[model samples]
Target: TQGKEKVDDAEEVKFEIWKKNSDKNSSMLEAKHDQHGIYTAKTVIKEPGTYTVQVHVTARKMHVMPKTDLSVN
Candidate 1:
């Protein structure tokens, strides 16, 4: 998955990917923060199974937050 974020402040945004079916105790993928706080992460699946993709977005010292859900077949 890939995404981009636009910010007016100089603060940096962090993004991470995790599995929804799991206990939410670990991350499946993590992307490095760019200059614009945008990032991209990849998840690999070998077997035919259903898995969910979770995207978490957070900014430094900011209240603005967002999340997204994705499905993989």
Candidate 2:
């Protein structure tokens, strides 16, 4: 939410990830809650480079997408 509160009862959570500027390596996966106020999704990328990860959160009729960049090294 706009208040930055915790969403413990989300209807769905997903992660859209890809290597920057490359759609061939892109993937979208449903995230699983670890029951620790955190969600996780895993994928194997053999190549090492920079990538973008976008988190999609849906709950209580609201949806938020937050993205960030990371390096695999």
Candidate 3:
């Protein structure tokens, strides 16, 4: 994920994924709907560390952002 603003379209699900490791930085990403109720995206994480992942979802004038942590081995 990187610092890129996603222009949200109407009536569509907009996903902006933000990732930052132990090092303070900026990034973001998105994925398509492959299965029912499931969204998938690919990201290249080479460094092994703790990453703060903030998920931003916007759809039909509804916006929700949740933050979590990811540890890579």
- What are the Cα lDDT values of the candidates? 0.49, 0.84, 0.56
lDDT of 2 by residue, 1-73 (tens): 3367766688899999889988647689999988745788888878798999998999889899999998988
* Candidate 3 minimal-lDDT segment of 10 residues: 1-10
User: All predictions: root-mean-square deviation over Cα?
Assistant: 5.3, 1.9, 8.3
The C-alpha TM-scores of every prediction are: 0.43, 0.83, 0.63
lDDT of 1 by residue, 1-73 (tens): 1225564342333444445666665454555555454566555655453444444444444444366665556
Off by over 4 Å in 1: 1-5, 8-10, 28-61
Ranking by lDDT: 2, 3, 1
lDDT of candidate 2 vs native?
Answer: 0.84
Tens digits of lDDT, candidate 3, 1-73: 1125343342333344334533446466665655544555677787776777666666556666767877888
Q: What is the full ranking by TM-score, best candidate first? A: 2, 3, 1
Report residue 55 deviation for candidate 1 (angstroms).
5.5
Ten-residue region with minimum lDDT total, candidate 2: 1-10
